[model samples]
Each structure stands twice: as C-alpha cells, then as structure tokens.
Target: MRFSLTCLGRKKPRLLASEILKNVEALKTPAKPLRSQEAEFIQAPDLSVNPFFQQLPPTLANFFKKYPPAPFRKYADKPVATNAEDANPFLPNKNPVTGRYAAPKYSLRRQSDLYKAAYRFGIAHLLPKLGNNKKFYEDKHLNKTPVRGSVMFKLTKGERTKDSRIQEVNEALSKADEIIAEHRGRAYRRKLERKSQQTTPWF
Candidate 1:
C-alpha cells in the first residue's frame, strides 16, 4: 500500500510513494454536493487567497492553459501554491437544492485542486459533446459514490520536510497526467498494473 523513495544521497529522504499515491487517488473523484439544507456552499475563492492552477505540475498547468477552468479573466493570472483544499471545482457554484453556500476550505494537509480540475475538465469536455443530455453529470460526476473516487489528496499524518512534500506532489502529478492522457480521463489500478515497471532516479 506504500513505498518509499529516498533521495540519491539517502541523507535527504524524498517523498514516500504512498503519500504521492494518496494525492493522485484524491483527484479522481469530484467533490460531493451537500445534500443537507444546512450544508454550506463555498464561494469563489480569490486566486490570491487560494490558487488552484499555478501550483500544478507543468503538464497539468499547460493543459488548463489550453483549456481554461472558467471564462473568468482572473483565471488568466498565475495561481500560486494553495495550501491544499483549492482542488474542489464546486466552490464557485452552490447546490441548486441546498441553498446554503460558502467559500473553499483550506488545510496544510491537503494537496491543491490542480489535478482534480483535469478530471472535471474531462467531464466538461464530455459535457458539450452531450448537449442537453446531463445524465453523466447527474449520475456519474456528481454521484456520491462516483464510479471514480475523491479529489481529497490528504496530507501525511506527520509533518514532512519541504522537499519531500514537493516531490510527492510532483510524482503524483506526473502519474496523474499520464493517466489523464492515456485513458481519455480515467484511471484504474488494473490498467496501471499493465504499465511497464519503471523506477525513478534509475536506481
């Protein structure tokens, strides 16, 4: 369930493979809407306060550039590293059913919203093609038990050195980008298992 990748020197421990896996798994699922009337909806966060795109690895960042997350002009600006929690795409909109709405939640433990935007963007890509048919959105994308998974990317239980954290994000993003590109926006463990076993740093 977990793997460790120490830096070349072994003196500086890089991020753990398990931690990187957690981030990648989180982005696969869309955030669930609050069904409770009291469930608060999040507001559109200022890119300054919580950036979603800028912090992403280059592959994903460029993809969003080619396909903007929103038509808003603010999206054009470079987003800085968010303290996790920025990955949720639902923040800008309130649940039509649950009137209660609020702003995005932040945590030092969560990964930014960057990778998730990719999957939802794929959902967006599928949307226009469907025209009025909203079945995918209603049944799959928004479904609580999405056939996919969550976009959480929870932080490790303990504090990690800055470099380890960065590496974790980088590896997760890289793995995620490949999944998005190859599967037409879906990832499953079985398919990943089919990949040629490769190691980083060429140990």
Candidate 2:
C-alpha cells in the first residue's frame, strides 16, 4: 500500500513551478530611484542700476528716479512756468497804446472785496427792485433809487441827471480805491508778521 501511495504521488503530475518562477527575479529588481519632485529656485539678478536710466540726461534721469515714468509721460505736454508773472497771463501792465497803467481784466464774478464795493456803490442803482423790501437804515440796501426806471429796464428820461450818475460813479471808484488800499496795507502787515515769526527762534 505504501508503494501504491508513492506511485500515486508521482502520478499527481509535478505542478508548473518553473513557469511561476520565471518572472520572480525580474520582480525582485529594485525600481529605478523615483525622480525628485522638489523644485530648484535660482536667485534673480540684481537691478540697482538700469541701463536705460543711465542713458537718459542727468536732469531727466533724476526726475524719473523721483517720479514714475507714466506720470512724466502723461503731463509732458503741459506747460510749466518757472515764475509767478509768467504763470499769470493777465498780470497788470502799462498799456502801450494808452500810456497808462491798466489793472488786470478780471471777470466780475471774482470774489474781491473791492469789486463788491464798486458794484454796490456804482451799479446798485440800476436795479431798484432789490431794495423794495430790504431795509436801508442799517446801510444794507440803497436808501433811494438813484435812477428812475423799472427794476429791470432803464428809462428814456430819468429823474437823475447825467451829472448825478457821474457823481455816483466817482464815489464808487473812490470807495473801490480805498478798499484796495486797505487790502494792500493788511497784506503788507501780514507779510511782516510772517517774517518776524520766522526770524524768532522757537527753541
């Protein structure tokens, strides 16, 4: 019976071990070392001096260094005056034709005290309606209508004569001159005060 068992084992057929073992050595070979995923960062080059900026003129280069290139390009077309007189085109000057000093031609809307006084004393009579309800006892409005006419329109023949209108105009001009003189005095005083303050040592 033992011989029969041995015979049966031999007859069971040798399992296909050689076929399974064929690729075992290949599998045992270590995989190629995995490629590193960490990135290498190289330092950027220095930019203390720019070649383009070096090529520019000294003044232009200095200006560009202080201000960006965009604003310089944007305002390049605008004119810049070096002094105050050049900046103000309407500055007072002697009229060549008249041989007289002429004040700067300013618009009537400018908020100058002299101009206000001139308009109040000189041109106030042209409109009487403005004073119809306003009180004149406090020197607010015109006490009497200097010219006889509707508030908005002028009369062909008014109660006031040409002489009276001339007188009013003269009075107005004198008042405007006084106001201008007073303003100049005040400005001079202020300038002196500022100079004194600057000269005085704070510490």
Candidate 3:
C-alpha cells in the first residue's frame, strides 16, 4: 500500500519482487467507482494538462509541440513541484458538496484505471487537431519551433532544486504511509520482515 524509494547514489530503486507480487494481488479486484452517480452529471477536468507533455520546454512549442498545462495547476509556472498537493489529480475543485475541498465522482477515479481510459480518449481526439495547427513559430526547413512567452529552461530547473520540491515529496510520502497504515496490515508485517532480514547476520 505504501511504497518508498530511497535514491541511492542517484539510482532509483526498483520495486521488490514480493512488493510487485503484492501489487498484483491488490489489482485482482479491479477498482470500481465508489458509487454510482449520474455519469453525465459529473464534471470532468480540463484535459489540457498532460504530465509528460506539459513538463517539456514550451520554447520548443510547434505544430507537433504541444505545451499542455500541468494538472492541478493552471500552468507549470506555479511555485510547486511535480508531487505537490496541488499536483494531485484528485485534488477537489474549489467548491465541494461535503467540505471546502471535495472532488466529484469523475475526479475521484483519477488514480484508477477508468481515469486512464478517459485520458487516452481525450488525447486521441486532441492530438490530431494539435498536429494540424502550425501557429507556433518554427523554422520549416530545420523543423525547429519556438513557443511564445516560454519560460527559460534554467528557471524551470531552478524551481526543481528549491526546498519546496523536497518538502512536497516528503509530505506526499507521509500521506501515502497514513493511507497504507489504515488498510495494509499484511504490508506492515512484510515491511518489518524485510527490515529484519536485511540486518540478520548470516552464519
């Protein structure tokens, strides 16, 4: 339920074999919508945000270069990192039914398979239109394109190095632990087992 990856010498750790097995087990029961709401009544998010595409340098924007906004934020110009709370796809709209921050049915499924399907559906429709428009400045022969009002790449790089990014990642990881603590009893046991195994001396 909770996954932590400690970067070792800048290397990203891979998931443990058993952890992968646990994830497979968790996936056995395909996730479903929490409740049946009028699908039409549910408001979906603006599909303008594509995590991968949006993170690109907009200066390279061209007919084929689409600089989508970062999800949760109107643009990547915000003072937040990739894992910031605002970056959470499930973040509630400014208004809510139950509380100040409540997400609708469609938003609740952002982390689920259903959301993925919808995202693909949106991209399939949007990509072609983007491909056709040659509005952004470009060097036709060289195939070089530049985005209007694009932030310098160095500015973007500096933001990632700021302390805010580290704090945001830590907070996100803590929230994950809280969620896992609630429903991952076996996971906790396994965590302890693995910790112990790592320290046990052999012969």
Ranking by TM-score: 1, 3, 2
| Candidate 3, poorest ten consecutive residues by summed lDDT | 124-133
Tens digit per residue, CA lDDT, model 3, 12-123: 6789999999999998978776554555357563333446555433332231233233332332222233333443222333333343543422233222333233244453
Error of 3 at 160 (Å): 7.7
Q: Which stretches of candidate 1 lie over 4 Å from their true place?
A: 1-50, 72-138, 141-203
RMSD (Cα, Å) for all candidates, in order, is 39.6, 31.1, 40.9
Q: List the residue pairs that clash in candidate 1.
A: 26-150, 26-151, 29-149, 41-101, 41-102, 42-102, 42-103, 43-102, 43-103, 87-113
In candidate 2, what are the lDDT values of residues 52-167, reduced to their tens digit?
Answer: 54555454444334433332222222222323222221234455566665553332232132224434445322221221134333355547565554565654555447778889
Q: How many pairs collide in each candidate, listed in order?
A: 10, 0, 1
**TM-score top scorer:** 1
Which one wins by TM-score: 1 or 2?
Answer: 1
